[model samples]
Target: MNTHRTAHRLVSRAATAAALATALGLGAVHTATASAPSAAPLSVRPAAPGPDGGWHQNGLHLTAAENKKVNGFVARARRAERAISPGVRAAARISHAELVGFDQRLKSPDSLKRKVATWMLESPGQTVDASLRKINDAVRFTLQWPAGTYSQGVRTAAGLLSAWGNDSTRWANTWNRPTGYKAINSAWRAPRSGQLFEVQFHTPESKAAQLETHKLYEEQRLPGTPPERVRELQEQQDAIFAAVPVPPGAERLTAPARRLPSPDPARRLPAPAPAPVG
Candidate 1:
């Protein structure tokens, strides 16, 4: 469980989910006339696909029992999200919010099982209990504000959330280092169920870039994509993100300082050297 590697993969998936939702026009629908392009529907029923061509189902497929348990957990998490929405909305308003998007969805059984399988390959011996414990984003959301006001918006939201209930700052993560896209990713324990859910804060431009890069990200996930082709997809995404201008004050928004728990020694993997940035 090389914590760093695990964190990187989890955050990458979170970013990808956000980008996909935006691309699908599932985010804030401001105008009734606005329309998004249609694509093939995601399979609601879980059936493991074979590893051929560009598709792979090497990841874990959830058992019927596991799926039932996860579904129950997700339902409780959504209730928690609904309970907290008022406070979040009020806080954003006070922070001079420009636009906000609130969403809560259970990762389809197919998606969750795929991720679990990937985790198993990355860190063998992790049981279903361990995997479920790490599933923190069953209920997720994104918030956006004007470019220059991002810092204030984040601070206000954090403060309000802290005052509202238990804020898991130690478990919170941020991904602002990425070019074009900047986001503060945090988690909180729902008061009643103590289930963890994620919140993402971004600026309008960054959100738009995320939407633009969603297709590329999806393509890169194809099981049989050549390594070189994957690299090309990433470079294309980077180019689009590079063009998104970061407004003044946006760079100063920092994730709270907290020490993350160490990775389970039993599941630890050898840490790889950092990749060089061009």
Candidate 2:
């Protein structure tokens, strides 16, 4: 039975891979973490199509079951290209949904919140730096089975690009890279409901950052740390615990997040990437 299940899983993964290859063409596939120091969690959710004709959602709570759902969602998104041809913007919607579902599933919100805050506060680079750190942290945690929302965010981001062709430039901005590629990150937008936040990093570096971050988490958790070292780790954990963002609907969680500046018209551009005439 186990063998059969394993085979099934392999086949599913292969199918997904084949679909991605067909969609992305010869784009480089880099599965390493970015070089940024801090990152912000992209928060979004699902709702009626926004001004740009993309689905939107909020970023929060996730579960393992939802992760699978996200995977399924990506596969369907790829298939959608043939019919809806939703373009990168539509793909953006699918990506955010998968991630929001994942983040809400996390068991370590406090830890993720702390790491995100620290990265956002102390990181010396641009906004992308903060985003990269958060993405890495999220990816690392997700690998642990019942991982956190941040982890799911990483997965969702990669899946979006893989399933939907995007402009490279916008994707690069999400990772704080160069500004040449016409990527799908431009199609992202945030809505007031649902899960997952829309942001950038549709490039190869974003994927790299996720893989590398997972390695860091494994190394830090390696066995046989000195007592004092363990204490330090514990302290970091405690700090994170203190900084968790209370879920929006949680009765006990109440605090105001700084308001984001109004988005520019350029960021809200509505040119959907129409499919090639087949």
Candidate 3:
């Protein structure tokens, strides 16, 4: 995910530059509504130097062990991406009104009763796929969200960063790393329209405390599991990705992704937007 954030930083800068250039009339006028440039295509670039003076050529300069960690992480994230994409698309189709209302709730930051909905819906295939990409950037790659969920997501994302940054080998250790979240569950309400919601934590202490009662989920929870289950749970774990169909571009992850077996769909995939009190 750091890769996504770092990469998106590049995209955002490009978008801003494009906008600024157009605004200054230094180039042909472009509409503000014009689409921002897509983030760089997924490629294995070299790692840059580490602050500690260790090797890091872009993302490729990691030590052999670190490289394995990274590769393992990317493969897992990719598989998760593929598995979850369809679920996001499916949920979107089945719960359009709920998502619309949920989207509206996002505008109100301090609603005591109306917490911002975690589940977002988008059309399947391209729209959903693109949105997933953005979420990966927003959640996994970027450090954009509040800390608990953010850090937990980031540690998991570190593996992906290793991958996109060209250090796919880091994954095994990355996959084996402890996930901080206690549980992932959903809730539904029809206050105005059908809406689904979820909450994730950022604090390591909280996640660790929460993890005690939910240890069964640990193995399949992050990059440690197989691709098939990743797809299956993608819908339940993250409704946004669950609703979309996995794109052809997603194949690299699904096919050669993690070597683990698929977790059971029933256990891995929860119902739409329910709360996880644990």
Best by lDDT: 1
Deviation from native of the Cα of residue 263 in model 2, angstroms: 22
lDDT for each candidate structure = 0.53, 0.31, 0.27
Worst ten in a row by lDDT for model 2: 137-146
Candidate 1, 1-278: lDDT as tens digits: 59546544443333343334434433323311222211112333334333431223543355555555545554565455444444444444444554343422334555665565556556768765677778777655566777666666676555444444435643333344565345566777655557677667777777788888988987777555789999999898889888776766655565533334435331132211111223
Reference-based lDDT, residue 51, model 3: 68
Please report how far candidate 2 places residue 196 from its true position, in Å: 7.8
Can you give the lDDT of residue 56 in candidate 1?
38
Residue pairs whose backbone atoms clash in candidate 1? 1-267, 60-117
State, as a TM-score between 0 and 1, how close model 1 is to the true structure. Answer: 0.63
Looking at model 1, which ten-residue stretch has the lowest summed lDDT? 266-275
lDDT of model 1 at position 198: 68
C-alpha RMSD of candidate 3: 22.8
Per-residue lDDT of model 3, residues 1-278, tens digit only: 89657644442333333334333433211211221122122332324325653333212233344434434433444333322222222222221101111112111111110110111111223232232232221102101122323333333332222221112221111111133222222211122221222222112333333334343343344333577876555434343222223222212221112323224232222222211123
Best by TM-score: 1
TM-score of each: 0.63, 0.21, 0.20
